[model samples]
Target: MERLKQITSLASLAVFRELYNSQTDIYAIISRFLNEIISTNGKYNFTLTEITNLLNDSFGFTIPEAVVSTSLGRLDHITKERDIFSVDKEFERTSNDVSSLKDMSLQKSSDIVDGLINYIEKKKTYV
Candidate 1:
């Protein structure tokens, strides 16, 4: 009984760790998808099934809706605040430093959010 409890606890811990690990890539991809939607359609309302299908079709990987929702929580850009989309200030194909202030985000989402808002303002001029 003691060994069984230990095994179960360890297994659950591993699962949680995987879920909590660096999901930066997933967030970035989702952000890009949301941005494209906003740019073309002007709003986003992708249901869980739709997101699951999109991930499978676009990236060839299937993810649970719960996991995708958790990843989306890390995006930190898209919100109900005027439907603003936080985009990378400078997009570089080879750059992984999407967050402002390089790899370190001290002020957290505020900086990146500002950048995205500014980017949106510039985009408005073209529209």
Candidate 2:
């Protein structure tokens, strides 16, 4: 679609800047979402299904498996960590890397939606 192409053409910096300039309350919401994922040491371990359920509950969106897959791929590209995993027969992110998990969760928060969009846009550039 035209929108997808437009999104694809955007640079990562542009994407991040757009996200950073978004409303403050958005960031707060995102931060809260990220905080929820934080374990005792500020980390989380989630399988793809778990993430999908969490996102559905938090954002009220039905994120398709392909979409989640693409998002995970983009996140992996930017973070340069194998946060996405394949377990038994499902995809997952089970690392105890607290900071990374926080970042990913934050990125998925409504407040940081723009940032995540930017991250994905930028990730496309690198690929």
Candidate 3:
């Protein structure tokens, strides 16, 4: 569509400035949806693809998936982490890291993992 061409052609900063100067409907809608998600689910549950589609249709912007993933964190309303993960899979991963023991202190296990990962990065111990 013509709108898609416009959105994709313009640099994001220019688009943002134009959007900000002209209208904030996109931001308002996104913020409202994020608030609703938090009030009902307690955290961001929408995937990047979902948000991308929403923005493309509602705001008429050809938003990139990476931008949506990062933009949520930029907004104070949405809590964003580095990446998305399956909750069940994450639990299994953490449990496995903790020697397959469910009784271990979760905090302690997390700390250990954090420390090991940080140490590796700090020392540049890469394969």
lDDT of each: 0.44, 0.43, 0.44
What is the TM-score ranking, best to worst?
A: 3, 1, 2
Better of 2 and 3 by lDDT: 3
Show the colliding residue pairs in model 2: 26-111
How much is the lDDT of residue 39 in candidate 3?
39
Clashes of 2: 1
* lDDT ranking of the models: 1, 3, 2
Q: What CA RMSD would candidate 1 show?
A: 21.6
Model 1 bad stretches (over 4 Å): 1-43, 80-127
Best by TM-score: 3
Least well predicted 10-residue stretch by lDDT in candidate 3? 91-100
Which has the better TM-score: candidate 2, or candidate 3? 3
Which pairs clash in model 1? none
In model 3, the Cα lDDT at residue 52 comes to: 62
In model 3, which runs have C-alpha deviations exceeding 4 angstroms? Answer: 1-44, 81-127
Q: Please report, as a residue range, the 10-residue window in candidate 1 with the lowest summed lDDT.
A: 94-103
lDDT of 1 by residue, 46-98 (tens): 55455556544433344576666555555545332342323343423232222
